[model samples]
Each structure stands twice: as C-alpha cells, then as structure tokens.
Target: MSLLLDGVTVGYRGRPVFEGLTLPPVPAGSLVSVVGPNAVGKSTLLRSIAGLLPVAGRVELTGESLTAMPRPERVRRLGYLPQTLPQAVPLVAYETVFSACRSALGSWTNADTEAAIEAVFDRLGIRHLALRRLSEMSGGQRQMVGLAQVLVRRTPLLLLDEPTSALDLRWQLNVLSAVREAADAQGAIALVASHDLNLALRFCDQLLVLTPSGRIAMGAPEVILTPELLASAYGIEARIERCSRGHPIVLADQALSTG
Candidate 1:
C-alpha cells in the first residue's frame, strides 16, 4: 500500500475535525473515493496525505513517514491538485504544461519537457489548445490545464480535491476517466474527494465516507452508504438500488421530515 493513515487526527487552527480516523491500508493501483457533505473534513484528510496539513496521527506513504521527508521530496513523490488552482501568468498553454515538468524531470532541458507536455496534451485531448493563453480558455479547459500539472509532475500518489467541480458534463466524464487511466497506467494510488456519489459509484473501487461534521464511516460504499447511515448523516432517507452490474444507484428518499 502506498497510502496509510494510522489513527490520524486532523483539524484546522486547533479545532479538531476528525479524531482517531483509521482505515486499513489500501492496495496500490486502486482508486479510493472520499464522499461526504460539506465541512466533513474530506479535504482535510486529503491535504494531510498531501503533506500540506499537519496530522496528529501517523501518515505513511510507501512505508515512509510523511513528517520525515522534506517538502520538495514529498511533493516529488506525490501530486496534489487542490480545488482552486492559481491562474497561469499569461503563459501559452504548452509553456504552462512544460513548467510543471520541472519538478518531475528536473531543470535540465525544456526539450524533454516540451515533448512530455505535448504528449500529455495529446493524451488528454487538449493538443489543439497548446498555443492558446490560459486566460482565453473556458472554465473546463482551465481545469484540464490545472490537472495537466499533476500529470506532468508524474508522481506516484495523486490527491485530487473535487477534481470535476469546475468542469461541465463532458469534461467531467473525460477528467474522471483520465484520472483512473493515469493512476492505473502508472500503478499509482489515487484518492479523490467528490460530491457526486453517482460518479464515484461509476468510477471508484473503494470508498471512505465522512460524516456531515467530519468523522469516519470508513468502509466500501456498499457497506457505508446504507439508509441508516444516510438518515443519520444527511437527515434524509436513502435507497440503494442495484443494477445488473451490482453497483448501487442511490436515490434520496424525499420523506425527509415534517410530521
């Protein structure tokens, strides 16, 4: 397993969000989805794995303690795509992609960087926009470029925060498929925080659901996304139906409250 959180407790500014958050180590080359209502500390758990947030409990990647590694080294080993990516400085699309490779391939040559950048663009279906400026692209294109960074970085562990939040429907499907392909193709572990339960059900193999206020309901989606769990966490009735594939299609039972 490349990712392990052993009794990890996380918070922001001394306010604990989740305590004693523990899960069995996940096997590599699998996609793990984190789903919960807002403010549930899903992002907090991801940030901790990315080493951007402090963890009260142990966090290990590839059997190495996150605290034991320096920032650059850890970043080199892990790719983090936060929800809000900074605006590119009017750089051409290809240039921006090339810049991301500096961390992975080093500062030697922009030649190799340029080649890999184009390859990523081709693989991601964005090669046509290579000459365009960052400010000119639509929201979804910008999101794709932001995602291209983590791809060009080519790290073994990817932590994505609501990766499809800014994308439209087609782009959303493309981006999620790309995420799965990238992770499995390279044998890297990926953890994604998503609000779209249906999308997660379609794409991910495992799940770690959080409470509305932030605590672990740690298990597979089938085990954790029951009517009882949904009633308690979201105060709504939930029906989990199985299609022919055995994957659950969740429907919110609208009889929420009001006697």
Candidate 2:
C-alpha cells in the first residue's frame, strides 16, 4: 500500500501555498516527517491530504482516490491529529479515547474496544493517566491523550500535525517511537509534520522538506538533510553531523539574515 500525490495544489483565497506539488509514492510502513519553517505549509499539506481542505489534483492511496472516497471510508482509512490540542473537557482520559475509538470503529464490541484502548494507553505509557480527568492533566499529558485517541483508531494512514509539540524530550522520544512502532506493526503510512529536525531525522524513515519559497524535497534523511537544503529552507547555516549511534543531527551554527 502507498500514497501518491500528483500535481496537487492548495492555497487560501486564491493565494497558493503550493501548486503542482507531486511526490513519489510513500510506501506503507514508512514514517515520514514533514519539516519546514513556520508558515511554509506543513500543516496545510497534512490538512489537504486529510481532505480537510480543497485540492486541485489527485490524492490516491493504493490506487483508490482518497479525494473521491466516501466520508466514512476516508475516515476509516485515515486518522488526523490537528496542531491544536484537544479542548480541556471534564471527561477523563479513558473516556476521551473511548469515545474516539467508538466513533471510528462503531462495529467493534465493547470488550474489543476496551482492549484496543488499553493497548494504546500501554503503548503510549499513559495508563496512569487513563482515569485522570483531562482538565486535571497537564498540557503534555493531554497531548498524549489526544494521540491515544488517534492511535486507538488504527487507521492505515495517519496525518499527525506537530504530535509532540508540547511534549518533553523523553516524552517526545516516546511518542515518536510509539508512532513509528504502530506504523511498522500495522503497515501503516504516517506523515508527521514537525519542527524538530533532529527528532525527525532520528525517527522517520523519510523527510519531506518544504522550503519557505515553496520548494519541496523528499528523500531519506541522509540524502535530504544537507547544508544547502538547511540554508534554503530554514535560513540557517547548519552542519550535519552523525551522532554516536550514526543518526544524522543538524547543528545550527548561525541564522542567515533575511533582510
């Protein structure tokens, strides 16, 4: 299974963020990070793929046109977590995740649903927070709950917008690791929009870079995370160095003057 975007165009009020944006098919079991500076359309790209925004061209998944699929079918095949955190409701974490699971998988029996919920909570290491009310949880805890809500759905395609933005360093690693594990276990395709290049390089199989000037780059981290790409996309004079574990890391030595 794979996702293909062909000549896709998206914009707001006739002002195009990107036009004719196409990419090689993103295969199942691959976790891709969409990275760019602020306002470079990372969120817009995810929203477009999630069918939350109007688009001009083809978005197909395993030969099925996602743009033309029925709403329920689309919902079943894809799960999206927005940049904004879930609202601080009076509901407990378990209740919030349960509602999301039931809403997405209505045919699942209660026992199966609870099992799935428990599995996700365990995977996220949030079992302790399950009974805690959302209003009582910190922003990071609530963010984990939001992710659990999406993860419990078990959709084939996951579009996560800044999934770890509010997380601490350890939790960020945990969240991305969980996401990567889920994608590999289920043969799912996960497109994560992140500002943290080091984390993306470490966890993602591929990187989709969006430059401020509307350029797009997609490849393995080693192939795509170059000094030139960094200078152009982020306006930073950065060096790419391999970590002790051989993972690529970006070191921003200086910021280029935009003026």
Candidate 3:
C-alpha cells in the first residue's frame, strides 16, 4: 500500500535534478502529496516512480522492488496519469483511455470495453464527451481524460502528476477526495504532485514538500507546512494556521524582497 523510495536520485540524460532524496517509511493506505516550486523535478519524480524515467535508487511498493520490472507487469500494479496528456494519436476521447488496457484487455468484447469506458467517464463526470476528439477539448477537459485513463486501471498504487492543476476548484476537491476514497475502500497508496496546498493538506494523509532545490521535506501537514519551511522552499514569508477541524492553511505574509 506504501510507495517507498530509498536514497532516490533522479535525472535526465546525465543531468541531475534531485540527489539523495530519501523518503521516510510511510505505512499502508496513505495519500502523500508533493509540492514544490515550478520545475523542481516534481514531475520527474512521478515519472521515475511510474517507470517512465530511470533513476539510481530503489522504488518499492509494499516492500517489492519496482525498478527494471516489465512495463506490463508494472501496469498491473501501478497506475500513472501524467499532468500533460499529449495527443499521441488522433483519438476520440473515449478511445484514447480505453487503449490503456488494450494489451491485457484482449478477449473482452467491444461492448464490454464500451461499458467499462462509460463507467470510467461516469465516475469522473465526463461521460458526455465520449465521441469528441481530444484535440478539440480544452486543457482541463483533456486532463480529465488522462485521469480517466489511469482511473480505469484497477491497481493498488496510483501516481498522479499535478492532478488538480487544470481542474477548477470543485473538481480539485472532487479528484483529491476520489483519491482518498480509493485508499479507504481499496487499501491503495497514492503519490500525488499538486499545486494547491490546502487541498493537499485536507485530503492527503501525509505530505512530502519538495524544496525549490529538490530536497525532501516529509511529514504530516503540521510538521511540514510551517512558516520556516514555506519561507525556505517558496522564498516567501508564510504562516501556517489551523482550522477548527484541525486542518492546515498557509497564509503568505509578504512578497519577496529583491535585495
């Protein structure tokens, strides 16, 4: 249920982004959120865990090493929905997501596939756009399609890259709540990269705040979302407050001073 990385270092073509990024041992059925300055390798970390990028560390799920595993094998256990869903081909929105299981869903009839696809669309509130082409949809709509593709995957480990960026406020809460429901009902572990700090604190059981320099700042919301950490990571004076329900909120105190 947990996705553990030990001394993880990720890079591209020999150019490093993060080094010695050791995450603590998180228990099962946990939702962990990662927030950092733009281009701090947040997406790269997600890609590395999903097997889309190679790294010089161990990524394990429930004590099982995931490095170098075959893509199909990994797909059975891990579901990845990237933030940017490039139109790989001129695909109808429904068809693109249905193709995710094209390899393993061989024997299922077209009717069955359609039914399954419809269910996914219905879950994400996008069933009405079944026949539309991907290129014609707005950025937010296309992002939902990408998420639907991964949600179609009934796996234990879910990796979402900026799941709420393109989504509006309501969908942001909806999608993150969906992640929480998945963990509660199915005993799943989710690693999410998100920009909305409040949603992350509210929905995620744990927080993994990556610094602007790509260092690891891991803990619960209260421990990790302090003014000191915010100032260090985002270079802004911020105060972390607690709501009546005990959830956290970050109040930015001042703009940066160019000294």
For candidate 3, lDDT tens digit of each residue in 117-178? Answer: 78778877888777888878887888888887777665788889988788798878778877
List candidate 1 stretches off by more than 4 Å.
107-111, 213-215, 243-247
Q: How do all models score by TM-score? A: 0.91, 0.98, 0.89
Residue 108 shift from truth in candidate 3, angstroms: 6.0
RMSD per model, one decimal: 2.2, 0.8, 2.3
lDDT of 2 by residue, 30-144 (tens): 9999999999999999999999999999999999999899888898999999999988899999999999988878899999999999999999999999999999888889999
Per lDDT, the best of the predicted structures is 2
Best by TM-score: 2
Candidate 2 lDDT at 95 equals: 96
Query: After superposition, which runs of candidate 3 have C-alpha atoms over 4 Å from their true positions?
Result: 88-90, 104-115, 243-246
Backbone clash numbers for all candidates listed: 0, 0, 0
lDDT by candidate, in order shown: 0.80, 0.94, 0.80
